[model samples]
Target: MNPNDRSIVALVMTGHGLVHTYELSIPIFMTAWLGELGVSEAALGAVVGAGYFLFGAGALPGGVLVDRFGSRRLIAGCFVGMGGAFVLLGLLPGLWGLGAALLAWGAAASVYHPAGLALISTGVQQRGRALAYHGIAGNVGIAGGPLATALLLLAFDWPTVAVLLGLPALLAAVGAWRTSFDERAAVGVHDAPDAGHGEPSPRPDDRAALWTRSKALFASGFAGVFVLVALSGLYYRGMLTFLPDLLTPLVTVDLPIDVAAGRYVYAGLLAVGIAGQYVGGRLSDHARTEWALAGALAVLAAVAVVFLPVAGVGTAALLAVSAVLGFFLFLVQPLYQATVAEYTPPEARGLSYGYTYLAIFGVGAAGAAGAGGLLQIAGPPLLFGALAGLALLGASLSGGLAVRRARVGTHP
Candidate 1:
């Protein structure tokens, strides 16, 4: 790859890492908030769910903004907003304040996926490899964020840790502002027709154009992919939201050394996703993305079905099972991302990603509340079973999409 490609990948990966760092760290803080604020787990989950809902909800508009303004501008703004929100989180001193801070952070963080992934799809040459590297960076943040937050909790309080965590966003904002890239080259369109150069330009009608594009996308069978992603989102959020709490009871063996056992195990499980992302990304490049997605979801369904019983055996067995679960959990990400790109036109890539994330994150945010409710009422077995069902549903949708694509003999 060229130097420009490398730079683009690096910038997008950095933003991806920062976004997940803030996102995944929230769960670690949730445990602290429960004790300090004296709130029920359900109440705390509601607050977190609100933030996640905003995160997903904002993505479609954020994509529109990225398409209009350019990805670099939106990404830089995201970092600034996220950083400021975290600073407020540190300074504020009440549950209400915390809720406000999280809401603000979610709004800010929502821009990253649409902007970063759109940037990658447009700017990079080795799209698959770039996406693989991007997934790796995200998994790194997923694993490291919790581990770092857990270690920080051992020393400093949650507020102080939050303040420290906000620092990277500040740094990343500066990096984004200073870095230069050609948006026209990436998207293969000029922002405006060159009036000075006597170029013929059509009168702009933003709303009509956006609606027309969206209508075409849905009519072209993007709806099936959207449903598949939504199901994936539901399963992803439902299983992950309570994983740490779920695992707490299953660990029966003592560690060789003293550690925050739940946190350590949580981090280890997510760390394994890095390898999964690498494999998934690689496969998406070489194999059919829909087929890859269908296969991954099938395995994920099987894993979720067996998770409860295997988790009961012993610490080693539980950890091993958790590792397998983690592998399939993240492996579907790149496949779906690549599939979205395949199904959409180049000009509308940003908007396509916007709707994709809306399904994955916005509609998917219900998983947190749903999982929390199940844990409180039905318990782990039912929860795992529900997740397995969701995965199967997602796999069925993906398989249908694959069949449709084969029948049409074109990318859908």
Candidate 2:
């Protein structure tokens, strides 16, 4: 890549890492919040679910903003807003206050995927490689965030930990603000004649244009991909929300030193996803993304089915299974992201990612509620079974997509 591309990728990757660091770190605090705030599991789930809902539901608007305002501005704003929200979270005194902070955080976070992915899809030369690196950065954040939060909890209170966690984002915000890059130059779309002329282009009204795009996308089988993404999100969010809590009792590690076994195990599980993301991203560039997605979903289904049984075996077995599960879980992300790019036009990539994330994080927010409910009533077996079912559903949809693509002789 050129120096300019490298700079943009680095900046975006840094932002991506911080976004997820804040996101995944929240789960580590759930147990602490239960005791400190004196809330039921269901209520806590509802609160987190609300933030997650906005994280997704807000993406459409966020995408529009990205398309209008430019990706760099939105990404920089996300850093500031997310950091400020975390600072507020540290100072908040009640459940309602925490909820408000999370709401702010979610709103800020909602802008990231659309902006970042749009920047990458438009700016980067080797889209798949850039996406793989991007996924690796995010997985690093996922792996480190909870682990760091857990380790911090051992020394400082959750509030102080939240404050500390907000620091990196603030710094990233500064970095992003100072970094210079031309989105039009990187994407090369603005170089066309009349690109920046003060004359209006021969396009429909904004709403009409969006509607037309949406209809076209739906008619062209993007709807099926959207369904596959939503199901994947359901499985991803549902299984991950309470993975530490679920695995705590089942894992029996005999470490010599004092440590939060469950938290570390969770970290280890997510860390393995770095490899998964790399593999998935590379494979998406070479093979059919739908087929790759189907394979990953199949692995996820098998992992979900065997998760509980493996947990019963021993700590080693449980950790191994968790690692595998985490790998397949995150492996789907880059594949689906690449698939979305394949299915959309460069000019509308922001909007496409906006809808994609809405499915992934918005509808996917229900997974947390579903997991909490299942845990409350049916237990781990049913929860894992439900996850397995979701994965199977995704795999079936992906298989169907593959068939459809074959018949149409189109990559999307």
How far residue 186's Cα lies from its native spot in candidate 2, in Å, is 2.5
lDDT tens per residue, model 1, 1-412: 7777788888888888888888888877776776688876566667777788889999777766776887899999999989888888998888788889989999999988778866776676566677768866877789898889888888888899999989889888999899987643444433432211011112124878878878877886677888889999999888877777667668897767554466667778888887887788789879988988999999999999988788888888899999998888888887887888778665565566668778888888889888877776777888898999999999888988899899989856
Per-prediction TM-score to the true structure, in the order listed:
0.86, 0.88
- The weakest ten consecutive residues by lDDT in model 1 span 194-203
Off by over 4 Å in 2: 1-7, 119-133, 179-183, 187-205, 255-259, 341-350
Give candidate 1's root-mean-square deviation (CA, Å).
Answer: 5.2
**Over the stretch 1-412, how does candidate 2's per-residue lDDT look in tens digits?**
8776787789878988888998898888875786688876667777788888899998777777877888899999999999999999999888898989999999999988778876775666655566667766887788888888989988888899999888888898999999987664445543432211011112234888878877876776678888989999999889888877676677686777554467777878888887787788688889989899999999999999988888899988998898898788888888998787677655555456667778999999999888877877777888899999999999999999898889977756
Clashes of 2: 0
